[model samples]
Every structure is written in C-alpha cells, then in structure tokens.
Target: MTAGGDVGGHPVGPDVAEAAVPRPGPVRRFLLRRPGLVDAAVVTVFTGWALLLGLGADSMYWLHEVLGGPRVLLMQVTSAVLTLAGAVALVWRRRRPVLVAAVMTVLGVLSLALTGATNGFELGVALALYVVATTAPPRTLLAAAGASVLALLVGARVLPLARTVGAKSLGVDPDDADAFAAVTGSGPFGFATSPAWFAMAAPVVVLALLAVGLGTLVHARRQRVAALAEAARARAEEHAQRTRLAQASERAQIAREMHDVVAHSISVMVALGGGASAAFDWAPDRARAALDELVDTGRAALGDMRRILGVLHDDDGDGPAGDAPLEPQPGSLDLPRLVGRARTAGLAVRTSGLAVTGLDALDPALQLAVYRIVQESLTNTLRHAPVATDVEVDVRRRADAVEVVVTDRGGTAPATAGPGSRRGLVGMTERAAAFGGTVEAGPYGQGWRVRALLPWNEGDA
Candidate 1:
C-alpha cells in the first residue's frame, strides 16, 4: 500500500518505442537511394540497344542500294557520327531535357534528309521525348511531343524523295523504279502517287501519338509519386514536432515534482536543525530528539528525490540500473508515511479514515494525484502554521469520487502569496484536473483548508 504497483505487473512494452525505427521498403532499400547510378545504367542500356539495331540495319542490302559507291561510305560515316552524338544527347536528357530533345530532333531530320532510313537517331528522339515529358514544364513537354510528331510526319514524306535523289547522286540506279515501288509500296513521290504509301502514313501517325501518349502517362505517374512522397515527408516532420513538445512537457512536470519533494523536505530539515541548536543550550534530551527528527526527515527527502530522479532517467527507456528495478511511485496508501514525516517535522497532524476502502481500484495516476495533494497540503501547513495546535487530514470515498480535505488551526504567521506558495497550489490543481477533478483551497472558519474532489471511475481499474 506504500507505493503504486504496475496494474498488470507488466514491464515496459515495445509497441510504441519499436515503431519509431522503420524498416526500409523494397525499392527504397534497392536502387531508389542511388538515383544517379540508376539513371546512368538506364541511359547506357538503352543507347547500347539502339546502337545494336543501327549496326544491324547498316549491313542490310537496301542501305547499300540507296547509298552506293562513294555515297555509300559517306552515309555510313554520317550514320556513325549521328548515332554517337544522339546517344550522348539522350544520356544527358534528364539534366537538359529541352536541349537533348532539340539535338535528337535535328539528328532525326538530318538522317531522313540524307540516309532516308529509320536508325539509332530516331530511337534517341523517341527516348528524349519521354524524358521531356517527365522532367520539363507542361508547355515544354507539349511542345517537345509536337516536335517529335512533326519529325515523324516529315520523315515519312521526305524519305522517298531523298532515296531517289541519293541514288542518282551516287550514280546508282534505284533498284529499278517499278521494282522498288513494289517492294516498299512507295515511289519517289509516294505520298502523292501511291494510295498504299499514303495509307502507311496512318500507322506512322498513330505511332507518334502512341509515343507521346505513353510518355505523358509516365509523367503523370511520376507526378503522383512525387506528391505522395512530399506528403509523407510533411507528416513525418509534424510527428517529430509533436514528439519534441511532449518531451518538453514531460520534463517540466518532472521538474515541478522534484521541486515539491525537495523544497518541502529541505524546509523541514532546516526548521528541525534550528530547533535542535536552540534547545541544545537548555535541555540536552530535547536537543537529541530534534536532531533525530532532523536526520530522519533528511533521509526521507533524499529517498523521495531519488525516486523522482528515477522517473526522469527512465524516460529515455534506460532504467537507473541495468540489474536493479526502479522504485514504485507514491500513492494514496503512502499518506501515513507522509503524515508521519510531517509529525516528525513537529506539526500536530491528526488523521481520519486511515483504512479507506476502494483505494486500490483507482487508477495509478489518480492515486498519485491524491497522495501529492495531501503531501503538498501538509508541507504548506508545516511551513506556515508553526504555532497551530492541531491539523486534521481526512480521506473519504463517495459513490463517484475520492475526497481529501486538510485543515489546520490558525497560526500567528501572516499568510504570504510568494512564488513557492503559489506554485505548490498550482501543482495540486493541475494534478487533480488531470483526472477530471477539482480543488478548492482557502480560509475556513479559524484555519486554512484544502479540499480536492477526484473522480473515481471504478471501471477504469
């Protein structure tokens, strides 16, 4: 009955403390933390893929026919240069999207004008369109998409004309005009002369739209992911702010408890020390009693301070000693020891209802509140009522609440509204209010009285 035990005798659990440190998710644990490496790896893999396709196309018979003799060598050299340059531009697309898109666009157009073939440059342009859509502003993304679509349209129209002209310039007859048309379903002016060639432009148009649409969809997905990430970051910061505020509040409460315990104990020891010194000159036996009271009061105060310190130290989940358990907090059952200390301090304190029932049914916090209220009341009586002949301590349990009333006969000392006095009253009021309780302290009849009504919800046990 001297201290509050854990209701369930349970040690501290991990549900709250362990959740503070989270395990990283799969993507986050893998490549997401290394964005630069991921980007470089993506660019390298895509560019190498395009280069392989371009080199395979170079070995085809059609390229030899369209670009024959010295012109054949010229086109191969031009293709190599454009492929390498376009690859470099694509690699830097995320950093400078607009510039990369522009470079890819020009390379696509030059390849159409000279080689008249689909190659690595065209693939680079498509990849750059994707980069633009994801990284650039909305207007810039739309413009880049439009430019890519335009290049596709122009390539379809100009490739046929370029092929005929390139063949004549290379002094090679283009695979016989009728035979080439049959194979490719196009002529020198295929868009104008051939219905099938004009129909083929439809798929090219669809392809362009599909590329732009795919890029836009990817961009939307990226935007959503970024928004979610930002929200998570904001919530984490808010939670951290709240935790800091709670820690500060807990520290302040601990300080007040320490102050009440230490201040009251010190006052009693000092009073007893003075009494012992004065009595020693007249009566040795009286002096010996006061000295013994002084020693006992000092030791009690030291024990209380140590308990308060344990509460403070254990806040960080580290106990006072690895092998030793912390002391239990004082409760309503501890009021006798508290009153005994006051009597030893030389206060004429009398008690009623020492065996109050249903005390164990109250919550530990409420029990502590009741104990502190009585302790602080007795401490104040000892400090301000030295001449008072009688002080009464009462504990009563009603149907819905537990009531504590402390009354002391009037003292010759004048009542002062000093900081320490006001602080003690405030602490008592706060403790009661925590459990939907109320406290009233004022002069009653011929002495000071403190009455506290603390709610007792037995079901809370």
Candidate 2:
C-alpha cells in the first residue's frame, strides 16, 4: 500500500481530529480533570478549617453571637464571604500560581486584621508561601518571600491578641495560651512576656524560608537531570539508526559485485567446457586437456562463490554448522592452477617474478587479495582479448607489499566487449582496497594490463 493510504484503498484522514465536541461548563469540566480534583481537595480542607475555627471554637462564641445578631448580620456575612474567597483561590493555584499567591496573601492579611485570628486562615498563607517558592522563578520567589516576611511582621504588630491575661488578672477564668502560642510564636503579641520576642520569632520565620528554598533547589535539580538523560537517550538512538543504514548500504554493494564476478565468469567457463567435450573426437589431446582444466577451474570458482554466499547468508541467522570454520580460498599457492585454467580457455599463459623466498611470510588476507587480482585479470583477458592472444601473469614480493601484473598480447583484432566490462575492474579495485591496496587497469602496447599492489601485513579486510 502507498504511504498515508489505507490497506482498504482509502486515503488516510487527518492525524488530529477535526470536529470539536461541546464540553460541559467550567466547574463540571474542571471536576473531570486530574488537577481539578486536587484543587477541589485543597479547597475542602480549607473550608473544614474555617468551619471549625470560625463557628465551633468556644473562644469565637462571643464574636459569632455579636456578628450573627440581626442588627449587624452583615459582619457575619462579610466573614463568610472572606473565608469562601480564600478557599476558592486554591482552584487556580497551579495554573496561575503567582496570581493565586498574591490573592491569598492579601486575603490572609485582611482576615487577620478583621478577626484577630481564624481557624483555616493560616493554611491559606502557608499554601501561598509554598506556591511562591515552588512554582515561581528564584528571583520572583525571593521577592515574594521578602514581601511575605514584611506582611507577617506588620500583622504581628497591628493585630491585637485576645484578652487572656486581663481575664486572669480580673478573677474571670482565662483560656490556655499554648494553642495560640503554637501558631503565632513569641512576637510583640505572643503569650510570652520576654523582652526578646522578636528574636524568637525571627528564627522561626528564617527556618520556614530556608525550608522553602531547599525544597525548590532539590526539585529544580531533579528536573534538570531528567531533561539531560532524555536528550542523551535520543542521541544514542539516532546514532544506532545511522549505523544500521551504513551497514545495509555496504551489504548491497557487496552483493552487486559478487553477482557480476561469479555469474559471468562461471557461465562462460561452463559453455566453453561443454563445447570442448562435444568436439573431443575431432581434436583429441587438446580437447581432453581443455575439458580437464575447465572442470578444475569451474570447481575452484564454485567453492569461492559458495564461501562468499555463506558469509552473506550467515548474517541472517547463526550460520551453517553453527560456527564451523570457513573454507579457505586459493592464494599464491594456486597460481599454477589459475594459469592452467587460462591456457585451457584458449590463451597462451606465461609467468615471471613469482619468487617469495627468504621474505617474511604474508598475512592470509593479503595472499587471498593477490590471488583474486590475478584471477579477475585472467578472467577479463579471456572475456575481452582477441583469439590466440598470449597473457602474462607476474607477481613480486616487496619489503611491505606484493605487486601483481597481468598483461596480454593481442593476436589479431580485439575481442568483443561483454556486459559489465567496467564493473569487473571496479570489483578488482574494491577487493584490493579491502586490504589497504591499490589497482591500475587500462589498455597498453596492443593489449590490456591490470596491476595491483597490496600491503603484506595490513590489518583491514
């Protein structure tokens, strides 16, 4: 199927949905979202605190009665309105944290001024402080913290404490001061009578500030580390994808060269051998010798081709024989056989400069490279040189490299060019390059010559 088209013969639709469905109202939709649920829970906790402190506390009884009277019912109504507004501020705490924090801070200061101290009101202040520290940037948070500290100090000085000490001095029963002291420590209006009230309150405020700063630093550090790890993983995956693409391209090039080298040469050898066998009675010894050489040459080519095919197939699975040793190819040791094969193919083959005596032994890969170069050159001569041409095969070992030359003398006219004439030269060059070697091939002195120089101890394949 074509890309972006369905298998059922239809074009693919847009990736994103086109139609918009009508959603419920803001409150209903918010209740459905996850953050909305958390906001609802926070508001509920604040409401419970307001109820317990504003209505249920005995200390608030006189205040409630005075406010709840019909003559001044607006005071109680105002208190209820302020309490609800503080709780509602939490709904937008995460989405608009700075705005919510400012609203909560203003409401908290007003509530303390009007009622002295309420139950759930301190929670709003604490939540505002947390939002300022965690959600805002460092500079903004620091500014907010400084403003909050100033507000707290102003509240401590301006808001009057309930008359607990006067009740004790007058014969009226006094309420315990521990609960009030817990929430509002020894400042100007605390239960304590010490002269260093500001000193004691200073440490508590500093501790709260330090706690918020540390929490913000830890959270920011974790987020940065997570971002770095995600970027590293993406880069690693991209590198792996590029590596696979390169390997696939290399495999395709190898397959094309193998098809040209193995298929063309072997097909010609098979046809020549068959013709020679059929004409054996007409020409006895020459035909028989040609047939024998053809058989040997075809077998050698088949073996080399099989080894190459095995390597290709092995890439898809474990391998044939599950790790059996690969069958080795012909090297300089089989040069005579290669020459005989050329002779059988109707070419006069000669050799010179093949001495390897008293020289350091060559690596197996280099030996195979020299052999393939000679083999391809002879195959090209048989396929391209004129009939009755004499071919020369030469090999010499240098200090660090082995030089090979294949030269042919044209007899009458040049032989007809076959398919992939240039490709054979490319394959020969690729083989030499695989072992850090170089090849030169062109027509010279009435015929063509191919030469290759391969490193004796180069480590590449």
Global lDDT of model 1: 0.69
Q: Write the per-residue lDDT of candidate 2 for residues 117-211, one digit (tens) a residue.
A: 43455566556667667667788877766666566546544565323322222233334465434433465545354222343235336644764
Worst 10 residues of 2 by lDDT: 12-21
User: After superposition, which runs of candidate 2 have C-alpha atoms over 4 Å from their true positions?
Assistant: 1-91, 113-137, 140-211, 231-235, 242-246, 249-253, 256-264, 267-281, 284-302, 312-325, 353-355, 358-361, 386-388, 409-411, 418-423, 457-461
Instruction: After the best TM-score superposition of candidate 2, give how far the Cα of residue 23 lies from its true spot, in angstroms.
Output: 37
Cα-based lDDT at residue 388, candidate 2: 38
Global Cα RMSD, each model = 6.5, 11.2
Per-residue lDDT tens digits of candidate 1, residues 320-360? 53323456778877889888877766678889865787675
Q: Work out the TM-score per prediction.
A: 0.73, 0.65
lDDT of each: 0.69, 0.62
lDDT of 2 at 91: 77
Clashing pairs in 2: none
- Best candidate (score: TM-score): 1
Top-scoring candidate (lDDT): 1
